[model samples]
Target: MRPDEILIIDRDTVERCLAKQDPVALVESMLHHHAAGGTVLPAEGYLAWRNGVGAYTRAIAMLGGSDTSSGRTYGMKLINASVSNPGLGIERAGGFTVLFDPETARPTALVEAGFISAERTAAYTMSTLRVLGPAGFDEVSIVGCGTIARAHVRLLHRYFGAVRRIHVHDIDPERARRFASDVTGRFPEYTVDIHPDVHSCVSASQVLVTLTVSDEPYIEAGSLRPGTFVAHVSLDDLRPEVFEHAQAVYVDDLGLVCDNPRRILGALIRDGRVAVPGTSDAPGSGPGRAITGAYGDVLRGALPAVRPDDGFVVSNPFGMAVADVVMGRAVADLARAEGLGVMVDLLGAATRAGGAA
Candidate 1:
């Protein structure tokens, strides 16, 4: 491949490549690398504004790089979403991921990232479930019935053979029913039930996953049963009290969770209820509550796995960019091997045409 050429991997190719690879294993490996300090993760760049119709729209640019035994790779994922998208018959979030040449810092490939983003987020949930979830859980509940929730259900069906029943709820009852129908249609072995309210679904679950886009906290304390595991994927769905009362709380990254001002945990930190992990006043050290540790810590065996007696435990993944980079790199490598993407001479065209006047 020429330095001036860049591979453009469309959504179809991205999906195909991911199908042939093990996403959960990839996420686990990335988490291990992150825990070992083999990654560079910078603060995400965020921009939000109201559209012409007074609806909220936002874009996020996350940059990350990793140095592993195989090699070093860098990438960025730019995802944008609008609250009004669903009404217009479009997916709420979409974006592309750019993989850069490690040595030259130039673009190597651009892969469709919306699917990758959802898959990685779901993988995070599944990875945490392996360590923090109840053993032999036969049922699971999901709070949002959107794209992310679909990804979660798919991964759950793939990884957890014992989960035979899925309970789902959405603010829109129709959407909930549709999600249930889709799930059952695709996986005939599992039964999907739609609940009219979130609480009912939560009560029925041994493992609960919240994937809604609500900025307000509604899932209050006591919603989860004893020995339940919660994957707070949406970040803002759970009330602060839930975190305050959890038997143990684990996050993808301590600094990332505390740094984001929009999430519940960050607000708790600001209110002085939750202390930053590793500090002298953190939980178990003082009166303030503290996070147990990152899931990476658990994956590396630095932290103990959650037991049935742990009560209601929560794992909040703040969505790391390095995982996206790792997945993008994997897709790019597979695309290259199979010659799946279109190659365009990004820089050579202008140079060969003697520059435009």
Candidate 2:
């Protein structure tokens, strides 16, 4: 296998992969990977996401099909690690879609990425919420109108059908307006409100999902009504005091949150705060649902459900590679099923690739 080879696929391939993905297996694999001394370079974490994406996306646009810019190409590299002897069909960001592994690079397989970002994030969120407590939110206030913000709404919409009303507010009025229109247009049965400002949207909400990448906290704790479940996939979007009054704080990746620039849960973890299932010790699960400071522990009957007024429940995916691998495998199967991937024709050596790894 050569190091310089690249594999590529498109969006349709990702769809097939996700259709048969398994949540439990993926989560377990990720926990094992982290627990097994796997080093993590949180993508957004390492990149310092304040304004990194805005610049990166613009560079990508200028590189692709631009008459004014130089024809020089800037291909984005896919994050990788070899579990089996095989891994990755190359996946270029934006331009070259789908997960593809060139035979030379020894990439495991090409997979679809239809819901790669959203599903994985949602899976992590749901996993934390599942262990943390009940998330039977009827109506939700969403603060932020971006990709992950929309992902939160869509995924929640799938799980909690009772979410009939969504109060969406973005600093960008146009984006907020567009989101409300788009959501209502897609799901006519549900009513969405494009709040002119944050106060009108979040003041009395049961659950507030914050997806903005704000350096300053957008939603203050005093502003939040009692029983408001505040879960910000992005921490700085909400005020630090919000965590103080949180009855329950469910973080998917505790390590990520602890290291977050916002330091929302740093003090709590530092003080070795513990949570008893039924007690209102803030539904903060870390290290295991057992409070070890590892990945969250699983709680079946051991854990009590979320009450009517659990203040905050936040889950951070932190971009675990295992989730990527799990999703990668799913995409591979879909690619194989639909006969979409380029076969590794290493003569008889190709047969040896699967025998051991």
For 136-165, candidate 1 gives per-residue lDDT tens digits of 788999999999998988898888988899
Model 1 misplacement above 4 A: 280-287, 308-310, 348-357
Which lDDT value does model 1 have at 119?
95
Predictions in order: lDDT: 0.85, 0.50
lDDT of 2 by residue, 140-215 (tens): 7888776556656666666567778888888778778878888888778778877887887887466776666565
Q: Which runs of model 2 end up more than 4 angstroms from their true locations?
A: 1-7, 20-105, 110-114, 129-135, 260-295, 299-310, 341-357
For residue 79, model 1's alpha carbon misses the true position, in angstroms, by 0.5
Query: For residue 124, what is the lDDT in candidate 1?
Result: 90
Q: What local lDDT score does residue 160 receive in model 2, on the 0 to 100 scale?
A: 65
